[model samples]
Structure formats: C-alpha cells, structure tokens
Target: MERERVNRKIAAIFAADVAGYSRLMGMDEEGTLARLKAHRRELVDPKIVEYYGRIVKTTGDGMLVEFPSVVDAVRCAVEVQRGMVERNAEVPQGTRIEFRVGITVGDIIIEGGDIFGDRVNVAARLEQLAEPGGICVSGRVQEDTQGRLEIAFEDAGERQLKNIARPVRVYRVRPSAAAATARPALTLPEKPSAAVLPFQNMSGDPEQEYFADGMVEEIITALSRFKSLFVIARNSSFTYKGKAVDIKQVGRELGVRYVLEGSVRKAANRVRITGQLIDATTGAHLWADRFDGALEDIFDLQDRVATSVVGAIAPKLEQAEIERSERKPIGNLDAYDCYLRGMASLYQWSKESNDEALRLLYRSIELDPAFVSAYGAAAWCYVWRKTQGWVANSAQDKIEAIRLARRAVELGKDDAAALSAGGITFAHIAGDLDGGAAFIERALVLNPNLAGAWLNSGWVRVWLGEPEVAIEHLARAMRLSPLDPILFRMQGAMASAHLFAGHYDEASAWAEKALRENPNLQQGLRVAAASHALAGRLEEAQKAVARIRQLDPDFRISNMQDRLPAVLRPQDFARYAEGLRKAGLPG
Candidate 1:
C-alpha cells in the first residue's frame, strides 16, 4: 500500500476558547451568543488581523489561528486578553466572558482550508492549561519569544499533558501591559496601595451615616502614615460614597491594589464595625474583622475602629504581595520580592524553611542594604529559632539577632513593622525586656493601627508578668486581624497569659483552639498539656504530652524553661513548670 504524501508546513499554531462557555450559554443563551458574536466581530477578529494571523475556523465558543511567527501569536493573544479585561470591567463577573489562549511553534499538516497535526493537538492541550483570561505557551514558543517581547513568563514547569506522547514544559505569559490596561485610568504606585470606601450605614438611621464616613476618613488618614503604603486620598475614595459600585471598577479608577469596604451598625449605646479587605486586581477577599465597643465615647470608638482596620489589612496586603511575587519566575525577584519570599518561608515555621528565609532575607539585604523591614524580619527569624529550640550556637545566634535588630531599629525609627519585629526579637532573644517594650511602644505611637505592634506588645507584657495587660493586647491583635496567618501563635500566647493568670480552664480552651489550627505547634501542644493538667483534665493532658513527644522527642520538663521566652519571671516559670510536671513531662 502506498501512502499519499501529506502536505505539511511549519507554523505557529494558536488555539483559544471561551472558558465556561457552556455554563454561560446555559445561564443566558441569547445574551451569551450576542456578546460572544460582538466580541469576535469587534475585538478578536480585528486583533487577529492586525497581528497578521490567519483564522482557520471558528466553533461556537472558540477559534483556531495560525501565524507566521510565535511573536505575532503571543502579541495577538496578549492584546485579546487585555481587550477582554477592559470590555468585561463593566460586566458582572458571573456573565463576563474570558478566554484561555495557547501557542506553539511546530510542524503542521495542512489540508484545503483546514489543519491537523500533533502541534495542533499540543496547542489545544496548552489552552486547557491556561487560566481564564490567561495565556500559556510551549517551551519552544517561550524560547523563540525571549527578549523579543516585553511580556513576563512564569515557569509552570513540565506538565504531563493529556494523551500527549511526551511531557511539555508550559510557560504562563504575564503581560505587563495587561496590568497597565487593568487600571487604564491611573497608574499604581510602586508601594502597596489601598483605598478605604465609606462604610455603609446599616443602623437604619441616616444620622449614623456620618459615623461610618468619619470612620473611613480616620482609616484613610491613619493608613496614610505608613511609609510603606500608598493610600488613596479621602476625596477620591468618597466619590463612590453613595452609589453602588463594582470593586474592580473602583480599583481601576483609583489605581490601588486593595479595596476596603465595610459597614457600621449602632444600637442604643453600643456600636459594631465590620470591615473586609479585598484584592482589587483579582477581587479575592484577603482579611475581614469586626469591632464592637460602647458608644460612650463615639469619637474614641471611631479612632479605635479606624486603627483596628488598618492594623488588620496591612499584613494581609503584604501577604498578598508575597504570594504575587511567588507566582513570578525566580529570575524576576527584586529586593522586595526576595523579602516577600523570605517572609513566605518564615511563615511556614519549619527549621528548613526558617533557614531558607534567613538566606533569602540576607539576599534581600545584600540587594538593598538599608531595607529596614528585611533586617527586622531577619532578626525575628532568629527569635523563632530560639522558640523552636533549633538554635545550635546560642551565643553566635544571639549576637547576630541583636545586630540585625539594632540595625533595624536604628534605620527604621519611624517604621512600625521594623520597630515591632526588632523589638519583639530583642525581648525574646536578648532578654532586653525594657528596651524591647520601649521600642514596641514607640511603634504603637508611630502607627497605632499596626496589628504586629499590638501582638508584640502582648508578648512583652507576658514576659513582664502583666498577664491581664497581655490578654488585652493579644485580644486587640486578634480582633484587628482575625484572618492573620499567625493567628495560632496569637491564640497560643493567649493560653500562656491565661495560664499565668491562674485561669487554668481558659488556658486549656485557648491552647486547644491554637492546636486545632496547627496540630504540630510545639508551643500550643505544651500549653495544652500544661493547662489541661492544671485544670484536672488528666486524659487530655496526657494526649497533648504524647503529641509533644511525637513532635520533639527530647522534650523534658527540666529543659522546658529554656524553650520559653527568656524574660519570663521566676513565679510565672514556676507555675508553668509545675503544670508540666503534673502533665507527666519527662524529668
């Protein structure tokens, strides 16, 4: 049998489809078809032509395109994505149409007005890998377009593509222009930016509207003081005060990374304030918290609520940026990126991650020698190691920690994050309780809304043997940042405060809550065991002790005080040791 010679040619194959097309049609068939047609006619088809792409064919929800070069294909895809973003800005999210695009450079079999080949199959598979409103490309395409385009590529790593003979390394394109177009009305500042929209009045009295507006204005003013943040002015933010507006549109108009929208309710002599922080670019809710206080001092309550909201979302914004930095390719790491990545590693709370965090923080410092937050964060890493009983060379670690903390404090006299981090490190690692407390108090004065400062103050008070004050500080931190990633740590500190206050049952309950969040938290486990034992829950205490043994086999009651903060008073340490002994900890 003789095989007919197949006509073939090398080309850049482009594949695209509307994500969730069937669902959109199911929801609104006529409207979906009309919008899809309008998009193709106005945006997609024009972009394809402008980029010198030949549209091979079109299905109801997708189309196949061929280009002379990979550059043309990628450029066209990015334009389409950007155009879709702009067009859908006004459209409701549920009904918005987003496209997934993929491109590859390979040989293709050509027929009369049609095409078929493995390259075509690869392009379709790559499209499936792309996120909605995103583009993915084969490694070959990425190599060809290197330095030829202004787009950034995130290495998605090798993926075992469906039904493909071999694995394909995919790269997700992150177009810088897409971000620019996302906020066409304004350019975002380099620093983390946010806007505080006027809180809605849910108190059923129009008179309460002033209270909500006043709360937002105070928040805006307090947030403006953070040197690290770029806050939208009150005048600009209040433009949407009385109107129903989309968060994404607000983000675009204001050119900010985060949007805070909340509500206020007043009843009798008591008032409640609820706030939520959202990532403007992606519309993801990052943090939310509520504050309740008496209306005896309305202005004072407003000030407290404002400070609380800022305290909560600042870390969340940083966390969101860290996650964003992680998504970028390793080659794209700047000084801030390195710092963010280091913070991410630090939060993992493992020995290995802690080491990596230190290395990355040092790298960040090497890149920017005067980065105060990096120095402060690095100092805290050593403090974390001391708490975990992971310090191998105590003298060397203490010297390095002190050096870093002092540098942070000296350089960042007005930086709250740096001051708080450095101050806590001093208290925990150097036993400079008074010095650390002074620095943290200064941080609070500088940025009263900083949650980290409040948290650090809580621990400082614990070491100072002010258990009641510690509880209050920790409670403030919790209410300010309820969704904080380190919430378990806060809860554990609360348990310790309760334990030292002779509230054994409260200590046990708080420790159990911390354990629920992180079963392997050694501090939480120890607190749980001690509190349960002291509260006469012998069975629960035994269970916690067993888990503590599992986590750290060398745990002993005699050496337990060494694992605790250095500044704990003799009486508090005695109480903790007695509870551990009752819990049957090793002698």
Candidate 2:
C-alpha cells in the first residue's frame, strides 16, 4: 500500500532566523536559548497570533510560520522588528539580539504538521540574504501586501538564490533609520534622470525575445514624455545584452543614478511581468514587484507596471493624475503589437531596418489611425532620410514628413513623441524655429519625464543661438537616456552649443568627449574643427576639416542648410558658418 500524502492550499510561507545565531550560541548556548524562549514567549508568539499567523515549528534559533494572507506575514514581521528594537534598546550592545526574516507566497505541501516545498526553501534563502534585523520579502508578497501596510518597501532586484531554479525578485521594507535617512536626501534634480533596460522574457520562448525587447522600447517611448527626467537612451543599455550585470555597474556605465529592469513572460492567455528599481551608488534595492494578468489585458499590465515603477522612484506619482493625462487607441491590440515590432526594427538604426520600421509603423497606423506613436515614428523615418540624404525625392519626402508630424501632433497633443517629432519637423523642414522651440518646451512642461523632448529642445535652443540654455537641456537629456545610442548626438549638440557661444575650450573638450564615443561623428568633427580654429589652433582645425572632407567630400558651410535642419536663427547660422570658415572649410 502506498503512503498517503496530505495536500493543503498554501497561501504564504514565512521563514525567519537570527543572524549570528551560531556565534551567540557558541558564546552562551544556554543563555541564548533561554533569551530566545523568553523573547518568543513575551513578544514574537503573541504578535504572530495577533496577525492570525500559525507557528508551524521553532528551532533553537529560528521559526517557521504560515499565513493565509501575505499582509498578515509582513505585518507580523514589522511588529516583530519594532518589538525587538524596543527590547534591544534596554539591553547592552553586546547582548542585543537581532533577527533576519523572509516571506514568500507560494504553494506548499503539508506532511503531518510540518510544511515542506521549494516555497519554504526559497523563504529560508531570502532570510539568509536579509540584513540583520531587516525584513525581506519575495515579489509576490510585496504585491500582496502593498497599500495594506504603513511601511515603505525598497526593491532589492532579482537574486539567483542558492539551489533555486529561477531568479527571485525581492523587496526590503525600508528600515526606520533608512527611511529617515532617505527623507533628507530627497533633493530633486533640476532635470530628472532615468534608465530603461531590456525587459526579461519569462515565457521560456526564445523567439519571443524580440517581443520583450519591443516592450522595453515602447516603455522608453512612453516615459520619454516627461522632460524633467534625463532618460538613458536604449542603445546604451542594450550594449550589456546577454551579460549578468549588477545594476550598480549599469548605473556607472550609463552615468545615471536609477536603473529599471524587468522581465516578460507570456503563455497562451496569461502574461507575467517582474520589475525592480535600484539605487546605483549604495547597491540598495529601491523597489521590486511582479504583475501577472491575462494576455488580452497586456495594456493594463504595462500601464500598471509603468505606474508602479514611477511611483517607486517618485513617491509623489499619483495614479489618478496619470490616468487623466492621456489614453491610447482602443480595440486594436494587433496594431499595438505591430507598433512594438516596428520599434524593434527602428532600434537597429540601419537603412534596411528603417525601411522595415516604416512598413510596420504604417501598417500599425492603418490598423489604428489614432496610434499617435506610429505616426510620430513615421515622421522620424523621413527626418532620418533627410539627414542621411537617402531620399530619392527630397521635396516629396519633406512634404510627407511634415504632414505625418502634423497629424501626430493633432492626435497626440499630450504625448511626448508627437510634440518632439512635430517640433523637430517644424524647426528643421518648415523653418518655424520659434514655433518649434515653443512646442518642444510645451512637451517638456507637460511631461517632465520625457527624455526626447529635452534632447530635441536642447538642439532647438542651439539653433536659436542660446548655447548656454542648449547645454543645460542637453545635459538633462543625457541623464534621462544614459544608454541611448544617439547619446553621441547630445554630446555633439553640447559641443556645438559651446562653440557657438564662443566657449572654444569647452567646445573642444566636449567635442573630444563625443569623438571618444564615436570616432566618426560628423557633428563632433565640425564642432571640433571650429573650436580649434576659434582658439587659434590652425593646425588642429585643418586636420579636423580634412577628416570632415574625407568623410563628406562635398561638405561646405553655406550649403549646410540643405543637409541640416533649417531651425537656426540668423545669428546661430552665422556663428556656425564663421567657425567653419575659420576652420578652413572651402567656400
């Protein structure tokens, strides 16, 4: 006869242990055990029962508890810590006892009165990872307990626990001291800075990797609405592909302070997403969460994930306010899917990719005309064509770009992409410098988190002969899109702005920085040549100009209007032209 196995519906399993338990026991085994018993009897047991938690068992130094709700587990954990803190305050420093606790919500098996499963194993591991006297919970528990407690939680990111089959997302409830420390550090930046990394694909389908990648790009686009955040561009972050990296390293490499990483998994009709934020300097987990829903409800999932992420970083983020900002087109999930596909193509940055991107963007818009991002992207394609001189019909291309950009603005007046692309088109092709600058400014004011708006607006300011202002905006753009492939553009814009403002030394320095990243950056070359000339370094100016001519044989200052955007004020144009002439560009 086979032995009978008991099954029970397990909601959450909590495991806790004292840090340095062995050391304490070794020093005074009987005394330690006696104190542990006293503490359990006087504080821990009562609090667990108060929270409606069941104490499954207790070792000499640890305890295992089960709860029907994750909230109960966390509340009990907080109470345990608060009680311990007060108790320790009265004891000597050397004799003070501290406990590390971990909680997870998962299915488990019950044998007799003891619970056993991977869930229990995971909680044990998390407890070990927790700092002494701190509480760490899995992503599931964090979501389950959110808004049900008064304490704030910080994301610890995903950790590959010992013997675990997969990485676990973890969160640490901000300890009282940590929370107090954070309050005084809440000095807002003149411009906010952010980073978006590739979202993980949990679906176990290798082919769906592109879909996950597309989702991240879409998020970058969406968040690029706020002009205040210095958004790290996608290319910069994607460079770390396929590598197991620390978020702190990412922050350092990208030169941003905050890092966002997440994973996406989809199966049939269900989808699951996990995300976390980390402070780069301290390697501290700032926030972590998991969102699971039906595949048909992906839009809601994305919005919720974005909202949660923003709220984690900026506690003041209000759901009601974000919901009222704008809404995407409804009834066309396929179109939205296609738009994501198009974004993947656009990120490739080659002519072949651009062509494919155009096709997909147009197809998406055809499916849903109100998909404003698609229209904005289509307009960008034309801008790319004009910049690369790849257009077979410049007149027709500009006309189409202008039309698409205008339509994007009309449909997405509140969207960052629409305002950004429209402003770029108007400034570059339509020669509406002031109007374009104002539009970009409006986009930034409307969405302080939008990186693109700041970047484009910085360029607009440069064109308007306000290099000082341009540099300020461009620096903020760099902060927002630290990983952006087009970061060279921002650097080049800064150099050009400095050059136009007659800050030759600063221009040379910034141009060199840009050149270090991309040796063949045309704008950097132009600015470097001008800076060298203005600073009376004729030899370096000639060398830079030579490189420019080699790269573009027909390069000339006067004809630059045809090759570049026409958003420049007269003063700005003259300043650049004089620099080029001084740098020995042929008339």
TM-score to native of every candidate shown: 0.48, 0.62
Number of clashing pairs per prediction, in order: 0, 32
* Predicted structure 2: lDDT: 0.78
Evaluate all candidate structures by whole-model CA lDDT and list the values in order. Answer: 0.81, 0.78
Where is model 1 poorest over a 10-residue stretch in terms of lDDT? 324-333
Query: On residues 1-587, what C-alpha lDDT tens digit does candidate 1 reach at each position?
Result: 99999999999999999999999999999999999999998889988997899999988798899999889899889878877887898698889999999899899999999999999999999999999999999999999998787688999999998888999999999955645464343434566778888889999997556566656755665565565666665555776778897897788677687899999898987888888888886699988877888765444555555455555556555543322212111122256567767876786888999999999999988988888878998999998888777888888999999999999999898777789989998898889999999999999877655667888999999889898999999976764444455788889899999999999999989998988888878888888888898889889988998888887888897787568888989998888888888888989
Residue 571 displacement (Å), model 2: 3.7
lDDT of 2 by residue, 39-124 (tens): 88888898898778988998868899999988888988986887687667758776667999999989999888889889999999
Best by lDDT: 1
Clashes of 2: 32
